[model samples]
Target: MRHDHHGRTHRLELDDQSLRTWDSTVLASDPEDGLVLDRSAFYPGGGGQPPDQGVLLWGGVQTRIVGVRPRDDLWLVPDPDDPLPPVGTQVRGAVDDDRRSLLMRTHSGLHVLRGVMARDFGVPVTGGNMEPGQARLDFDLAEVPAGFKESLTEKLNAEVAADRAIQVRVLPRAQAYALGPIVKTATDLLPPDLEDIRLVDVVGLDLQADGGTHVASTKQIGRIEVAKVENKGRGFRRIRLKLVD
Candidate 1:
């Protein structure tokens, strides 16, 4: 049996390699120059990160694959009419630069917030989602402090202004296990191939096992404001934010 390996597999070398030059299978019916590959590192909008919006250039027509989906071992781009490249044909894929950049910053900013909550308020993330211009991260906190909204807003923006480097990598299971555990309660949520888990580390700040794209530095995130904070449950609070001047 042929082992099908494609979907959601974090490329450990993405940090070093150009994300645009991935060698992929032509999972389409009709061959084209710009066709979406079967397996892509592009996080199909999930867990809050909006689906990536990008163009697929083939022949002379530039087709946009503005959506992404994770299916077993395949990154499914649902474009019915758009012809698919042959099974073995190679193609060049490029992300929507502007949109992607915003997402990168937003994702990194969320991580900073997650780290801050963990260190200062003793909270762990419960859920989160990042849109184009705004983001919301949910945390497990017993009480929503009265002054924390303003203070957290200030603290997070300060970190972004400090311009800390955002690091990303794929670690072997053993190495990943060696790091201090930050994922609490849902250890079972880990995929069986723990060795292939991607780790997103913010130098001197935070470390998380994530597969989403991110900015290289926090400075690019610009000034962020905590727009609101609300109670979601007995011990859960959600923080909402957006970019500001």
Candidate 2:
């Protein structure tokens, strides 16, 4: 199976992160299992990023997609009150641009934070979570290094101001791992059976095997404010950040 495909659905988002709308055919639709499309741009939630919400239009009607079930077949969860397009129906699918765009920026901003942490602090991320405009990443560090929050905030915005380019690529599993500890986390979450690895690189800064949407450049991430830094005990520190306009 190709990395760009999830079961029977040819995942359009993986190839074109900027794609907001497309046309596709309904391959399966059920009240219980939800709808499956021949081609879909709806990004199923993964890597701390939530799934996309959108709508499918057909014959003067619309079925709002609220969530996604990433099973053997990608199942698009529809609004319970909305109507589902029957199989074989041609539908126009549209992703919520505002939500997805914010997510891309927020996800990219976190990468900049990760890069700064690894470069300056020499710590590994233990866990993290994100929403549209805000995110938090936990790192394995014993000392706070005095004025850590203020210092980190300055470094993060500097990278954003520098406008570093962000690139995405797919490489064979062995070739990806050969780059020397690509995973920045304390725990390795990558699947062992995967043959192809998708990588996101913040050029000249950080690179890791990731399956998430991101902006084209650090400049697009805008201003990153280190909101808070907490001591989670046992040498774990949680850093919360927000994107400022």
Candidate 3:
């Protein structure tokens, strides 16, 4: 869900993530409950990517933020069960760069994997999930052929070597629909009043409507290894993967 507190959405880390620390004011929050900033660099856990963990700083008082979620607004939950500061207070928000970096690599790896699978075998992945350093994707197919893992591993590395620039665009609904995103489910997950669709594009590779943080280029993802594969009956197969970097 999109968060619009005080009629402003969080200026997300869409274009560049070079800025690790964000100096902003609290837009809205409950003193007994949560924190909502005017702008944030934290990823609010969506599209199989997990939320970012960091800290909120103000007046030398540092509050650890273990998780961030979107309700009507991006609620910042403090760790050690601390109470939230009042609204309109100044604070510095920072994301765990190491964690975010791993997520970026893992997230981009999956997209490249999806593109390669679709291109090489013409198979659409049914579902997927991203973890700290690894991810798993499911494909609805009868059985895997011999040497499938080797072939997939080669393709994934080749894409990372391609060094493609990952682009993001907030497109109008009509323009976004023309791109034909491969949605995971029949139920639309986008916000009901969402006028613009965020399109994640791996240039010369893949394009889809997505909401997640990613590395700027495919090269940043380094390499990928197909760690495991689970054969689920009824034509379902799950493949687990890890980022080589």
TM-score of each: 0.82, 0.99, 0.90
Q: Residue 61 of model 1: what lDDT?
A: 57
Give the higher-lDDT candidate: 1 or 2.
Answer: 2
lDDT of 2 by residue, 1-245 (tens): 99999999999999999999999999999999999999999999998999999999999999999999999999999999999899999999999999999999999999999999999888999999999999999999999988889999999999999999999999999999998778999989898999999999999889998999989999999999999999999899999999988
**If ranked by TM-score, best first, what sequence of candidates would result?**
2, 3, 1
Candidate 2: list runs displaced more than 4 Å: none
State the lDDT of candidate 1 residue by residue for 1-245, as single tens digits: 12123443443224542264354445543322233365454556644678666655555654457576555543546355665555565555566767777777888889889878877877667777778768998887887767989999989988898899988776676777689873532234776755466678888888877767788888988889999998888987889988774
lDDT of each: 0.68, 0.95, 0.79
Better of 1 and 3 by TM-score: 3
Best by lDDT: 2
Candidate with the larger lDDT of 2 and 3: 2
Best by TM-score: 2
Q: Give the 10-residue window scoring lowest on summed lDDT in candidate 3.
A: 1-10
Candidate 3 per-residue lDDT, tens place, 122-181, comes to 666777899879999888767688998888888889889999999877777777887776
Model 2: worst 10 consecutive residues (lDDT sum): 179-188
